[model samples]
Every structure is written in structure tokens, then in C-alpha cells.
Target: MVKSVAAPQAKGKSAEDKIFGANNRAVALSEKLGADKVINGTVGSMLDEDGNLIMLDVVQKAYKALTPKEIVAYAPIQGYPDYLEAAIDQCFGESRPEGYIRACATSGGSGVLHHVIHNYSEWGDEVLTSDWHWGAYGSMCNDNGRKLREFELLTPDGHFNMESFKANVSDMVAKQYNTVIIMNSPANNPTGYGLSDSEWDEVLAFLKDVVKGKDKNIIFVSDVAYLDYSGEKHECRKFFKKFGNMPDNVLIVVAYTCSKGFTMYGQRMGAMICVTPNKDIADEFVAINQYTSRATWSNSNSAAMKVMANICKDPAKVAELDAERAKYFHLIQERADLFMKEADECGLKYLRYISGFFITIPMEGSQKVCDELEKENIFLVPLGKGIRLAVCSVSKKKIHGLAAKIKSTLDAVGAKQ
Candidate 1:
């Protein structure tokens, strides 16, 4: 009788998430087997060598200095002006494009997806992204009553598949009034691949060709959640300059987040930045997305915004924060270098990895492989085509020969063909 009272869409909906399910199992196993013995690679959150969550000292210092009003008072629905400015500066740096820019406070990069999916695209429209992507894109689209369409992420020769990208975007724009394309680059999660500047040229050129004279709207979402870890700071962001002076119909949305960038995951602070040559479109983006935010979470954390502004406003604070993040970035790089070297030596195959929190190894029966790995107290999250290992969460010493161990495990499971 109670089930009969639920709406059609809400019926049969449960709260179980696959990634979280795997993470929970990892937690239980780690407690029983001891943390040092287990390789916990279930999630993207950065962890120290001792299996503790990482928090930047400078970020902590900045946040702890906030006043009570900063903690409790309601912030503007669009976000505080100073935080908006900081988000812009932090995201684009010196290579900021020549366009009108503004940000709407979002819960995280996930919130950016929610706002764009709800505000830009119509109902029943399928959002487009690459095949290898963060799993939440699909979750967010499904929850919004929309769907996700993916094109091949890489070509047979290991390059960005521009042909597939163009074909998919062109077809989708033909069907829908607005086509939203989300590209996770500059340390893409789970795969760690970032497009080169030439690839960016191809992407922008293709987009310009797609909507040359058409009235169709193209919302290009560049999700740079892992940008800070990708490569050299300024070089990685040079692509942002390419967004300037694009056609009025094309709007660039940067899904900027403090969760990864500033190590403030729990605070859930970030911004949905819109860049466009047309000033009116930028204004509309702020208005509509803020309306969506007001109707959803109402407002963001004020203390986090204040801390972000404080860090950005002070030159010394900026350098301290940068150096703090840089230390962890190098730590993760060392872990990855060791693992990649060992994986190569052992002849184990994985996706192309740049520098990021995760790397994926291809294997059949993902769930089964993950289950078998648990017997060794080694936890990894299963994906559609492989298993994702979060190098950012595992230490260099533990990662020394993880690849060989996994290879041995695959052979034992009769999956190493």
C-alpha cells in the first residue's frame, strides 16, 4: 500500500551506488586486515600515506581564521562577489580569455552538471561526453530525467577521436535545440588523459564548424576538476585562451571545483563559470543557474567562500597554498611513476595516463575481478571496461609493485589472456 502511493518516477528508486558500495566494502576490509596491508583505490579523494584524508595546512589556516558571520550567515544565491572573482582567477590564471566571465556558486562540479543539464538542455535531451568519463555524469543526467550519450574517447592510434566527437555533436545538435558537451580534460579522472593544445584547436574548430550559421546552441563544459594535478601550472591552462571570441551561439562553461583544487572536499564549494563574447548570454547564465540553485540547495557554504577569497586576495597566501598543493602533486606523481614503470615491466596494460588521482586497467569481468582482488585485501573500484586505481590515495611504498601483483592476481583468476 505504501509503494502504491509513490509517483511513477520515484517508484522503485533505491539509494545504492556502485562506487560507494565498493568503498564501503573497502572500509570494512581495511578495519579488519589493518590499513597498511590493503590498497584502497576505491575513490578519488586524496589520502596520506597512513590512509588519512589530506588537508592543506595553508587552506586550513585560511579557513580557521574565518569569523562566525562567515560560517553562519546566508550567502548570496549567486555566490559572494570575491569568491566569484577568485574562482575566475584560480581557474584561468593569466591565460584568461577575452570575454565576459561570471560564476554561479555550485555545490561542486557535480552541481555544475545538474545546473547545466536542468537549465540549458530540454527534457529528454541526451547530454554528450567522451566514453571514458566520471561516472557521476550519467547519474546526474538520469536523475534529471535526461540521458547521456558518449562517443569513442580515443582513436586506435591513441589520439583524441575528433571524428567521432564531431559526428556525435553534429547529430545531437540537429535533433535538440541545445547540445551540451562535457569534456573532462587536464587530468581527467579515472584515466588521467589530457588533450594537447592542438587537440583543443581541433575541438574548438569542430565546434565552430558545427554551428556555423545555425540557430542551435552549443554549451561546451570543460570539467577541470583535476587541472591542478595535470602538469605544469600555467602550461596546462593555456587552452582557456582559445575560448575567446567564439560565435555567440557557443558558450564555454568551466566546471571549477574547490574539492580537488583547494582540498576542501567536505565543504562542497565550487563555481559554474560561464565565458562568452556576448555579455547578455553571460548575464542570463548567471540568472538561470542561480534560479536553479535557489530551487535546489538554496545557497552554498559561506565560510568556504570567505576562505577562498582570503587565500586568493593575499599574495603570500597564494604562494603558500600553491606550494602546499604542489607537494602533494609531486607525491602523487612519484606514486604514479613507480606504478607505471612496474606495470610496464610486468607487461600489464592500462589506459593512457598523464598525471591525476586515478588510472584504469583494462580487464574482463570487472565486478568479478574486483571481488577476487578483495581476497588479497586489495580494494579497487570496478568500471564498465576496467578497474580504476586511485594513486592519489595509495602511498609510493605501497604502489611500488602493485601492477605486478595485479597481474599475478589476474593470472590466478584465469583472466590474463
Candidate 2:
């Protein structure tokens, strides 16, 4: 008798299931928030008058310009050569880190993260990162049967805790598992903190010691998702140069996404860059990454890649785009500053935010507080640990109401105690 071999029940939840599950957290919270005017900080997009995303203008123009023939064809599995070259040049700029490196296009930054976890790390391997991080890190690792380990992020003085970081690295090394450390910086999400040159030196030194003469591999992945939002562009770009000089045991992978920078969220175009000490390692990393990509999403959107490449290649267009983006970036800063000022006036302490879309405010029972805020038509993410306010999406006119709502929630919670 021929036995039917049904596909192995998929491990964990399918990607679609996971995404919807994650989103339901916000949806549930929103529903509880009631009929109040909702200022949705959880959403990542900028909306128009009709509540549709405003940033689609850039993408629609790019799409209309493409030839019908181009739209109908398949992009190379590795991605268009021109798109790859343009993306690499735009990211690395003139410095072009002095190593043999290659880039592969992926569905988005999230896809790149999943590919790295599956391709490079073994099952049950541990990924190290700060305690405060984008929530998706845990989801990605868990779905793949990998453990997510964290180190305390702040010192007593409220700076990047180097000692704690090094100790965490040592603990992971002693366990003898291949480790991947993801640092999201320049303009980090949630807390909005960036590492200084000194802190970077400390991290590199610790990694050097951990991997010294040990045949085991260590991967340092940088998620530069909010790179363009930083006020100091030159300083932010300088950090990429450090990756060029790391040892061979250290593989530097940069996941750069156009979603946030170009306001191309729906396009889902992003690059997975692997930089190695020499040509051979670079070639191998590229091959493995491409294999992972093929096994997963195949290749990313061809039309989006072409548009990004064209815009990046034209200097005049690039300048115009940067100028336009700067207006929104500054608006984010202005709104954040206003909120911070009001938070101070109300004695509502929050984590220091240099530059980024969100700020985390500490409060007991954050989920409860978030629910209450929703009743007032003020919506934000309840992070369990704290409340994450997306300053970028909330209009300047809405800042005062947000501040008042947050302060009242905190006060009520404190009084109950």
C-alpha cells in the first residue's frame, strides 16, 4: 500500500499567522480604547486625509514610469544587478568598507532577519541582544526554535552598559553556541538610543576577546532601519566603517530597508548585506544567503527595486527626495520635543530619546494604562515593560492631549496603590 506522506505539519505558526497574531495585540487594545479620537502610535505609516498612506506618492510615480515589459518579467533570483549596485553604493557611499562583500534582495528587513536565523545559526542556538529591542526579534527566533538572550541595556549612569554587555558575551561564549548579536542604532526604535564611538570600541573589543582563536563563528548584525531619521547623518554613516575592519571570525551583516527611509513600507524592498575579511568568505556568505532567500520568498518586488535604483542613481532627484524627507524628520523631532517638555511639566519621566520615532515611558501596569488612554481617543502601544509612544505619527496639535492623557493615567494608577 502506498502511504500518503502529507507535508510535515509546519513548525510553529505560518508567517501570515504570526503577523496577524502580532497585529491582534494592537487591534484588541484599540477596540478597548472605545469611541475616542484614536491617535494610533502603533501604526508605522503616515496617513493622508482619507486615512490612506500619504507616502505612496513616491512609489506610485516610480511604478507608473516603469515599462509594461519590465513589470511582466521576473527579476533575477539574486535581484537586478543595477538595483544591487545602486543600493550598495547608496548605503556604503564613498567609504565602501574595504572587504569583499555582496548584497541579496529580500522581501523586507523581516525576511532578511528570518533568512539569517535559519541559514547561519543551528537549531536551539542563542541570539544575543539588548533587553530593549524591537518585538519581532523574539518572534523570529522563537518561530525558528532559536533562543533569544538579552543583556541589560543601561548602566547606572544611563549609558550603554559595557560591563554588562561584555559579561553577557562571555556567558554566551562559555555555553559554546554560535552567537548572533543584533545592534539597532543611530536612531533605535522604542528607546531611541545610539552608541557612541567609545561604546562601539568597547563592544568590538569584547567580541574580539570572545572569538579570539576559537574556530566558532560570531555574527554581528546591524539593523539600520531608521538610519535616515538621525540628526547627525555623517556620524551615523561613520559607524558602518567599523564593520569593514572586523576579523574574519566576525561576519558583519547589515539589513537595510527602504520601507522607513523612502516611505516604501508596502513595497517591502530591502537588502541583506554580508561583509567578510576576504573574497572567499564573501562569496560563500552570498551563496548561502541567496539559497535561503530562494527557499523562502524567492525574490522581492522587481518594480520597487527598479524605482529605488533609479531614484538613488539620479543626484538631483536624490537631493530633492532627501529635502522632502527632512521636513518629516524635523516634524518628528518637533513633536517629540513638545511631548517631552509637557511630560517634564507633568513630572512624567521617560527614557532619553536622541532621535527616533518612538519613546518608552515607564509605568506600572502599562497595558492597563494603555487601555484607559484608548477611552480618551489617545492610542499607543503597551509594551508590558512600558508604554511606547510613536512621536512620528501623532500630529503636533495632538501632543498636548497625549501628554495629559498619559499623566492622568499614571496618576490614577499611582492613587490606586
Candidate 3:
């Protein structure tokens, strides 16, 4: 008989409301710089002009001639079988390492990272990576309640720091966490540094020593996203063979992406590879990874799988795609070279490693500099340590002008300070 008591409305913001959502650096820079027609190197977005669109048509025609599937149905949770096989073949190439290799299709390189962290690592576990890394590494790990640990990334000679790497691995082992070490090699992101064979030997030696007698479980996840753009294919992939007869406690996961290699950013195709000395481990990895994929994405894009499968299966089409990829790779290198040269002429102090589609400019007040550059119709990503400049999408004509713009911005800002 009594009137229903009305529930009090919430007085304050929810937890989601408290959280900062937008990328403030990118957003502020975009706004101050006038986002409308600014040239961008922030995200790895490739803008295909009329010419590039025409090239895509030619590639599509080749694909149709080979495997002409009109409609694409849902792919298996694990992925298209033929597509997975071709991806593995393309990665390993002629030199197949002696290990039990299994792969699972992922949304993209970042998707593979998400699956590995969510499925394999426990809450509050630690992941060790380079101090300077792709920003998303921290975002993904923190979202999953995992702690990211880092060590200094370079030596005095501007090479990979094996000593610092060993120290960090040994510390993680001491903490008794199921350690996951992600090595973004052969042109690491942000900095663009690769490990030499001797450097690899040192790191491997440390791993062998750390997990020598203990039953500790260690996973090495190699992010080889920029493999094709490294100038030398076989030389860059040599690290994969080193783990051929790896220890039972140690497993290798290769996160391979088609975004850079195949220029299929919209397709969102990639793979999570598990390499182990035992077939049983490989089987277990596949089963658990499939569960992770189901719980999250459920299934991958069918059209992407179909197109990739068609291209991989046809030898002539594969050759043609490779040639096309090489053309872009060379263009990226040319742009990077020109930008570096311009930076040198301007007396800019940048990180000395350059091997990929991007480079980090070591300027003070990177955010302010980025903002100033945006006013001039130029855009770049600002990192905690430095500013990341992508030289891939911009034209050769834009390279020198962009460098000059950056120099001017820095000078003006410096004078104000």
C-alpha cells in the first residue's frame, strides 16, 4: 500500500567517467595545429593517393585471377587453415627452425599481444620490455592488470644493451613471476634498433643460465612487425632459429602482422605463433589460444582471410605482392634517409638508430614542439621521452620541408622559454 521509495540518482561520476579516455597529446596537438588539412605521421595510417589506388586495383585483378571467391563467410576461430600455413611459410622462409610451430589468427599485431597477456599471464604478473617501446605495450598490459617492467635499452656504443637486459631478466626470475619478455627486434619501434647475432647469443646465454635448473616458466614473445622493411630478410630472422631446440620451460611466440608487410591495415590480419620443443606444449597453446579468441573476437574477418589465402596459395601472385612490398620498403628507407640528413644539417640531436618506417626526434619539450609543428600543418606523435616521426606516408618533397618546420618550431619555442 505504501508508495514505492524512489532510488536516489548517482551524485558523482562513475569509474569510467573518472578515467581519461582521449589521447590528450594527439588531441591537443591536432587542435592547436588545426586538424583539418595537417600532414600526419602520428598513426601508422597510409594514405593511398590516386596512383596507389590504381595499384591496388591491379593487385585485386591478380587476386581474382587466382582465387575468385565472391563472398566471404566467417573464418574458423583459429583462422583459415591455408592462410595460417602460408603465413608461417612466409615467416620462416627456406630455413624452418626445428621446433613444434603452431599459429592462431589474430585481429592484428596488437590483438596477438592482447590474447597472450589475457590468456597466459596471471593478474599482477610482470612483463619485461625495453624502456623505450611502443606506447600500446603499456596500455594493453595495464588494462589487463599486469605490471610492465623495463631496463635501459642501449649501450655506450649505441648498440643493444645485453648487460642491462640480463640484469632485468635475472631480477624477474628472482621475483618468481611467470616472466614474459617481448623483444621487438630488427628495427624496434620508436627507436629502430635491432640485436646483432653476438648480442642475441648473450641474451640467450643469460636465459639458459636463469632457467637452467629451475622449473620456472618463461615466454619470449618476438614482435617481428617490421621484418620485411629491415633491408635483409634472412639476416633479420636468424634469431628465430636460435630458439629451435629451446628448453621445455621456455616458449617462443611470434606476433606477425600483415598491416606493414602486406599493406592491409583495414583488413586487420595477423597471427600468434607458438614455438616449442615439445608437440604437446604446442597443442596446449593452440587449444587455450582458441578459447581466448572465442571469448573476445569470436571470429576473424572472412574477407581478409580469403584474400590472404588466395594471394599466398598462388606462386605468381605471391611473387607479385612481394615486389610491390619491396617498392614501398625502399620508399620508406628513402624518406627516412632524407629526413635524417635534414636533421643533421639542422644540428638536431636524435636517437642514432634508424631502420624502420619511423624515427624518434630527441628534442626538449616534445609536446610543445609537436604543437608548434601542427600550427604549420605538420603532425607527429609525442612520446614520453621524445617525438615519433613516421616517414612512410609523407612524400619525398614533404620530408625536407617538415624537417625545416620542426627546426623552426623548436627555435621559436626555445626563444620563448
Candidate 4:
């Protein structure tokens, strides 16, 4: 007889996520064969032409310069104060909305996401996001015993599906007391897609309308994990200003991560920043999320927090970090440009790519085509939406005309639509 074990939430729990599986295969193949012989686009983090993981000069210097005490000591449960403020400023830039704002330290963006879903959404209730999204969102929801509701990510005109979003949001609001929505942009994972300023306005307008005369709560989150690599200074954060003057029932949360921004993937430093027109909401946010922090993970990294705070607060250091990052930023841009140009030439249609680590090419038989591509030493992760090509991690040498190869493979396998 099976012994009584594991909670109900833990029963029938299993996920053989193909993304990580494919990534493992890619890394194994790269090791078995030579790295130069393979186009490994499976990993989401940045890598250079020599197949080296990117490390920001400022992060290395600032972190190493920390005292042994800073490295070894315990931090405040919510996060060191400086790190919390820096994380907020890093997310909003000069365009921070005029509203009450607060932040708490987290293990990483994923930690913040977990807290958001757990605290804001009812247990066993439904949450929402776009059809084309980072896979981890689904995992986080599933782990928390919440259902994921997805809407079309794009319209026929290749813009944000505002109508579909409104329809889904309204449907959920009618049924659920709290509707939590995740919107990742300025380099959405698995799809290099970013909504324009006007598109953002449309989304806000719809959300504002949904809150009108309704008792439901709106928890809108901006998953800004890759904000730094998304675009130019101030440009990537222009959407934040729109969050000001929002209704009291609406709460905007931005999940900020040091992993992608500072190239400190293992440090596991992140924060959750909340924005609201009401002071009560802001105070309640700090109270509730801070308690959640204590219950789970406790606090984030002290040394890493100090490092980021030092980098952000110092003018000279900030400039140095910016200059160092600009070099790789442009390198990523060049890679994306080459791949997109080739895709256009090869007649391969992909999702609208404003700027991001991924570009999803829409086609059927994603798994079949991806497996076939592996034989030719070319690797990418396939999603239900499409095949995700990580432009940020691939080199220019391999990116040039790579789309043509993918198209050719699709044709050979009769996977082309």
C-alpha cells in the first residue's frame, strides 16, 4: 500500500520541460563536438563569440571589492535598504511614475513572481498572461496551485492583441475576485517582442476600464528581467510613467533582477517594487510582501546587494558599467540584425521583434523541426507558439544567414507551412 505522503498540491507533480531538455542536449553536443561546430542558442543568458559567459566589469570589481564581513554576514530579511531602492530606480529610470512606491529584496525575479502569484491571487484561482510567454511563468503558477489563462499575443496587424486581452481579463474578473496578469516586455523571452508606447496606452486603458465599477482587484506585473538589454537608456523605461494616476484598485508591480542586468546569474539578487496611488496600499504592500519574504527565502544576497547599490549610487562607477555593457549590447544588436535580415530574405516569418534575447519564428511541427536541426549541429528551443532563437547568446559569425538554414531544414522535413 502506498504510504500517505506529500501534500495535495504535490501530487501528480512532474514537468519534463523541453526547453531545459533541449538546452542540455545543446550543451552536451557542444562538448562532444567542438563548440565552434555547433550553433548553441539554447541558453537564455548572454555569451560572447568565444563561447564565454558574459561578466560585467563593474559587477566583478564591485563584488570582489566587498569586505569579508559583507560577504559572510546576514542581511535584512526584506533586503538591505540600499539594494531595494537601487532596484526600484534601476527599473523606473527617470520615468518613474508619480505615485507611492515601495520595494523588497527577493532571491531573483522568479522569487518575486512566486510571491506575487501567491499573495495577490487566490489559491487554486486563475492567473493570466500572453500566449507567447516565458515558460517559467507557467511553472510558477502550477507550483502555486493556480491556473494559467492565456490570450493571443499578437493581432492580425502584428501588434499587441488589446481586444483579446480585454476579453480574457473581463472573463476572469467576472469569475475571480482577484485577477493577476503578467506582462513581460522590452525583450520578452522566447520571443523578442516589445509593445510600443501607444500599445501600452491601449493596455492601460483596457485595464482601467475593467476596474471601473467592479469590486475585483487588479495585480498587474511588469517582469523586467531583461530590461537592461532591451534598448537605449530611458527608452526602455518610458512605459513606467503611464502607471501614474492609476486607480486605487489597481496595483502595479515590477519584478527587477540583477541576473540579466548585471550579468550575475548565480548571485540570485532581485526585488519587487510596487506602485499605487494610495499610501495605504503602498504600506500594506511593504507589510505583506515583507512577511512573505521572511516565510520563504528570508533575504537576498548581502554582498551582491551591496555591489549593486555601490554601482548604482556612484556616478563614475555607473558610467563605467554603462560603457562596458554598451559594447556587448551593440554586439547583441548586430547579431539580431543579421538574423532578422536573413529571415526576411529566406521568407521565414517571425514574431514582431522590437528588441529582446529571443525571436520566435511561427511554424508547425516545432518539436520535429528542432530535433532535425540538432542533427546539423544547430540547436534552439521549440515552444507551442513557435521556435525560440536566442539572439543574445548566439554570435554574429553563426547568426549570419542562420535563418536560411532553419528555413531549409523546415522545407527538408516538410514542416514549412
Candidate 3 lDDT by residue in tens digits, 1-417: 645454443233134310122223444654675543456676554433311222343246644664334245677999989889978987776656788999999998988899888877788889989987887788788778887889878876688888788888888888865688888887788777888888887787678779988878788888988887776566667777877877878888989887777767767889998889999999999999999999989888776766777777888877787777667777778888888888888866567665776787766688788777766656677667777876665667667667767777888888221
3 or 4: which has the higher lDDT? Answer: 4
Runs of candidate 3 with Cα error greater than 4 angstroms are: 1-37, 47-59, 62-70, 415-417
Show the lowest summed lDDT stretch of 10 residues, model 4: 1-10
Going through the candidates in order, what is the number of backbone clashes in each? Answer: 0, 0, 1, 1
Which one wins on lDDT?
1
Ranking by lDDT: 1, 4, 2, 3
Which digits, one per residue and each the tens of the lDDT, describe model 2 over residues 216-298? 77888888888777764455678677777778888888888888878888788888888888778788877888888788878
> lDDT score of model 2?
0.76
Pairing residues by index, what is the TM-score of model 2?
Answer: 0.90
Model 1 alpha-carbon drift over 4 Å, by segment: 1-4
Residue pair clashes in candidate 4: 192-358
Candidates in descending TM-score order: 1, 4, 2, 3
Please give the lDDT score at residue 5 for candidate 1: 69
For 210-292, candidate 1 gives per-residue lDDT tens digits of: 89899998999999999888877788889999989899999999999999879998899999999899989999999999999
Clashing pairs in 1: none
Candidate 2, after superposition: displacement of residue 246 in Å?
1.0
Please identify model 4 stretches exceeding 4 Å from their true place. Answer: 1-5
